[model samples]
Target: METAGLVLAAGEGKRYGMPKALAKHGDRLLVQHAAETLRAAGCERRIVVLGAAADEVRAAAPDLPETVVNPDWATGMASSLKAGLAALAGTPAIAAVILLVDMPGVTAEAVRRILGHAARDALVMGGYGDRRGHPVLLGRDHWDGVARTATGDRGARDYLRTHDVRVVPVGDVADDHDIDTR
Candidate 1:
């Protein structure tokens, strides 16, 4: 499966009081870490969505495969989802795209496993130890459902909450967390 990397770096990190994507968790900036990890994990195509701090994030990874801007990002994660999906729609070779960004701790191996288990007709998401979180992998066939998420404050969460997604129990706690908010 040709998996693409979709890093949602557009979030303004309202609670973090800065651009969370740039928030450094270690040697590499958060966004860079996510991008480098995805790129290293064999993602043939990579798309990073940038909004509020677009220029900053874009500059962070100038060698990125593709970068799309979500002008409606202020509206929320749905907009970022729409923007990223729109950019990826043309790549038929793409089986699924893994969403990664500014989160503090997912290792590259975790993404490899998630991409390996991605079901053609479903989304991959589940609990991160004690919490439900991201790095959700949505197959190309399910793009429409995820795209329909353009009207809300999330990135396919509302629909995912109701539908049957292939829950990938992240064995690694780091791969299943959202660092900006908590």
Candidate 2:
């Protein structure tokens, strides 16, 4: 099955003091790192959602994958997630693996593992050891509802809570920590 990669990079990052997408992880910008990880995972197409400092981010990573600006980004993550999903409309992608811009610990391996578990009717959640986390795989079947439920900083969390999500262990290949806090 075909899958696309959605990198959520539209947050204001008030907690991190600036746009987390521009934050550096080692030598690469956070957005660049996230986008590269998604590409390395074999996503047929990658969509990045930018809000805060969108122009600066674009300039910083000129080679970044297809990107869209979320004008309602200040509203929260939901808008960005929705924007990313909308950008995938009418595509051949049977699923989308979501990656957060601030999460540098997520590896291509983890994303591939999640992609490997894609089902037309199921949601796959990447797990680090016993903890479920990012690089989530949302089957096309769940996209509409997931987008509808995405609100605030919740994204699909509310929908996932009310549904059955398959967890795939990927700790050996990735870390599930968020670089949001200073």
Worst 10 residues of 1 by lDDT: 173-182
Top candidate by TM-score: 2
The Cα local distance difference test for each model comes to: 0.72, 0.90
- lDDT of the structure predicted as candidate 1: 0.72
lDDT of 2 by residue, 84-143 (tens): 989988898888899999888899999988898887687999887778899898889998
Candidate closest to the true structure, highest lDDT: 2
**What are the per-residue Cα lDDT tens digits for candidate 1 across 1-182?**
56777887787889878877767767767777777877766777877788888888667656655788889988887888888888888876445555657664676666776677665575776447656666678877778887875475667777777777776666554455567564
TM-score of each: 0.86, 0.96
